[model samples]
Target: MVTFEYAPAPESRAVVDIKSSYGLFIGGEFTDPADGASFKSINPANEEVLADIAQAGVTDVDRAVAAARKAFSQTWSKMSGRDRGKYLFRIARIIQERARELAVLESIDNGKPIRESRDVDIPLVAAHFFYYAGWADKLEYAGYGVDPRPHGVAGQIIPWNFPMLMLAWKIAPALATGNTVVLKPAETTPLTALLFAEICQQADLPPGVVNILTGAGETGRLLVEHPDVDKVAFTGSTEVGKAIARSVAGTSKKATLELGGKAANIVFDDAPLDQAVEGIVNGIFFNQGHVCCAGSRLLVQESVYDDVLARLKRRLATLRVGDPLDKNTDVGAINSAEQLTRIRELSEVGEAEGAERWSPECVLPERGFWFAPTVFTGVSQAHRIAREEIFGPVLSVLTFRTPAEAVEKANNTPYGLSAGVWTDKGSRILWMSQQLRAGVVWANTFNKFDPTSPFGGYKESGYGREGGRHGLGAYLVPSERSGR
Candidate 1:
C-alpha cells in the first residue's frame, strides 16, 4: 500500500480559536457544570486533545430544563412571532458569516472531510434556519389552523455524525413555533453546538431561549426524562432511540426519533450506468456512510449487476482517502475509536458470512482512526452486513432478477428510512417508488437533502418527519379550528 502524505497545515487550524476548555451554555451565558465534572474532546483525525468539555450532571440538566421552561413562560412564548423570526434571521446570517470557521471547527471536531462540512453540512445548517425563519410569522397558514400552541420546553439530543446540521433541524423548528430549547450535543462532537450557542449570543437571542448542555448518554437520558420538557427530538442509533421512547412512554411529552437505517439503492437494467455508478458511490460513501438514511445496500438488476459492480470498483479506486483538510480527499477518518471498532467488526462479519469483499489500493493515516472505502459482492439477504446497519463507508451488493424481487428484498429489512431507484424509464421509477416502503424515495439520485422537503422513515427506522411544514407540526398543537 502506498502511504498518503498531506500538507502540514491547511488553514483549518488558524481559522478558528478553539478554547482550552468549554463550559455549558445556559441561560444565554457560558456556565461551569454544577458538579464540576469534565471530559476531554479530542480530534479523531490524530487523537489530539482538543478541549476540556463540561459534563452536565443531574443538577445541570435540571437547571437547563428550568431555564428553558422559564424562558418559555416569561420571554420566548410571550414574544410576537415576527420578533422571534427576526432573531432566527439574524442567527442565519451569522451562520453564513462564520461558515468557513464553522466548517473548519466541524472537521476538527467530527472527522468528516472539510469539503462536506464546508459545502453540505454548513450550508444546510444555515438554510434550515433561514427556511424556518420565513415560516415563523406565517405559521398560522401552515395547515395547523390558526394560533397553534408551542410545545413549551423541547429537549433535543443530536448525534455526533452531523452535529451542527442536526442542531439546526431541532432548534429552528422549535423556536419558529415559539418553543424554548434545552439541547445536548453528542459527546464526541460538542464544539460546533457550543459555537452555535455563541452565535445565539451574537444574535442577542433572549436568555434561556436556547441552552446547550454538554455530556454523554446519561446527560441525554436526563434531558429526555426531564418532567418539565414538553417535547423531545433526537437523531441517533435505533437502540438508544427505543430507550428514549420508553423513557417518555405514558407521559405527556411528545418525542420524535430519527433513528437508524439500512437503505436500499436499487439500479434497474435500464439505469444510466454512469449516473447510477455515481449514485451508488455517493449513497454509501457520503459522510463515511454514517448517515442514518445511508443507502448501504445496493440492489442492482442481475443483467447489469456485473457492469455496475465493475464501475463502482473503478470509481472507488479514484476516491482519495487521506487528511480531511485536503481538498482532494473524498474519504476521511472514522468519527471515533468506538465507532471504528463497530465498523471493523461488521465488515469482518460480512467476510465470515461468505461475502466477497474488495478494496482498491489505498493508504490510511497511521495516527488516526481511518477505514478505506470497501464493498462486498456475492452478499445475500441473510448476511449480517445486509441486515444490520454498519454505519461506515462500506457497501453491500445484492442482485435481483425482477422488480417484484427487488421490492421484496428492499422491504425485507426492519428499517424503512430511505431508498433510491435509478432508471431511464420514468414509469419504472414511479412504479418502484410507490412499491418501496421507505419514507423518501429518490428516482435517479441519492443522498440529496433539502430544507424545504420532509425527511424521515418507516418501521424500525423510527417515525416523525424532520423537515418542511410536516416538521413544524411536531412542535405545535393544532387549534380547535373547523378544519385541520
Candidate 2:
C-alpha cells in the first residue's frame, strides 16, 4: 500500500482567552466561595492548566439557591412569557455570535475535537435555546394544559460530555417556562458554563435569574438537597442518578435525569454494509464514545458478522486521534485522567474474561489522557464488557442467529437509554423498534440529536425527557383551574 501524508489544520487557540482563576457565578456576579476551596481545570489533550475554578460548598449552594428563589419569586415569575422569551432569544443570538469562542473553549476544557465542539456542540447549544425560546408564550398549547405555572427554582447538574449543550438542555426549558436556575456544570468542564453566565449578563437578563456554580460531587449534593430548590435536573452516571432520586425522595421537588447506557447497534445480513459500518463507527467512536447514548454494544447477524467486523475495523483505522484543537482530528483525548484509568481497567477486565480485543495501529500522545478506538469480538452475553457502560471508544461485538435472539440480547441490559437497528427490511426495522426497550431508537442512523426531539431513557437510565414540548413539562406545574 502507498502512504500519503496530510497537512495539519489546527484551530486557533487565540479565539478563547482563559482567566488565571475564576469564581462562582452567583446572583449574576462572580463571587468567591465561602470556604475558599478551588480546583484547576486542565486541557486533557496536553494536561495544560486551563483555569482555577471555585469549589462551591454548603454556603455557596445556599446563596445560589436563595438567589434563584428570589429571582423566581420576585422577577422571573412576574415577567410576561413574551418578555422571558425575548431574553432567551437574546441569549441564543449571543451564543451564535460567540460560537467560535465557545467552541474553542469547549474543545480545550472537555478534550473533544474542535470539529465536534464547533460543528456539533456549539450549534446544538444555540439551537436548543432558539427552539425553547419560541415555546415561552406557547406553553398554553403545549398539551400541558392552559396557564401552566413555573416550578420556582430549578437546580440543574450536568455532565462533562457535552457541557454547553447539556446546560442548554437544562436551562432553556427552565427559563422558557419562567423558572429561575442554579446550574452546576461538571467539575472538569465548568468554563463554558461561566462563559454562559457572561452571556446571560450581556442579554441583560435579570440578576439571580440564572446562576452557575462550580464544584465536585459534594457541591452537587448540596444543591440537589437544598430545600428551596423546587426542581432538579441531572445528566450523569446511573449510580449518581439513583442517588439523586434517593435524595429527592419524600420531597415535593420534581427531578429529571439523563443517565448512562450500553446501547446495542444491530446490523442484519441484508443491511447496507457500507452505511451500517459508518453507523457502527459513528455510534461507538463519536466523541470518543463519552456519549450517554453511545452504541457501545454491537449485535450482528451470524450470516454476515465477518463482513461487518472487517468494514468496521477498516473504518476505525482511518480515524485520527490527536490534538483536540486540530480541525481535522477525528477522535480526541479522554475527558480526564480518572476516566482514562477507568477505561483501561475495564478493557483489562474484558481481556481477562476471554474476549478478543483489537485496536488500530494508532500512536496516542504521551503527555495527556488518550485511548485508541477499541473493539471486542467473541463477546458473550455474560461478559462484563458486553453489559457495562465503558463510556469510551470501545465496542463489544456479539452475534445473533435470529431477530428474536437479537432483540433479546439488545434488551438484556439494565439500561434503556438508546439503541440502533440497521436493516434494509422495513418490517424488521419496525419490529425491532417496537421490541427494543430503549427510549430512543435509531433505525438507520446513529447519534443524531435535535432540539425538537425528546431524549431520555427508561429503567436504570433515569427518567423524564430533555427536549421538545415534553421537556417543557418538566419545569412547569398545571394551574388548579385546569382541573385534571
- Model 2 ranges off by over 4 Å: 480-484
Number of the top candidate by TM-score? 2
* Cα lDDT of model 2 by residue, 1-484, tens digit: 9988668999998988899999999999999999999999999999999889999999999999999988888999999889999999999999999999999999999999999999999999999999999999898988777889998999999999999999999999999999999999999999999999999999999999999999999999999999999999999999999999999999999999889999999999999999999999889899999999999999999999989988888988899999999988999999999999999999999999999999999999899999999999989999999998999999999999999999999999999999999999999999999999999999999999999999999999999999998899899898766566
Question: Global lDDT of each model?
Answer: 0.93, 0.94
Q: Estimate the overall C-alpha local distance difference test score of candidate 2.
A: 0.94
Clash pairs, model 2 backbone: none
Q: Which lDDT tens digits does candidate 1 get at residues 259-362? A: 99999999999989999999998999988888988899999999998898889889998898878887777888899999999999999999999999999999
Q: Per-prediction TM-score, please?
A: 0.98, 0.99
CA shift of 56, model 1, Å = 0.3
TM accuracy, model 1: 0.98
Clashes in candidate 1: how many?
A: 0
Clash numbers, per candidate: 0, 0
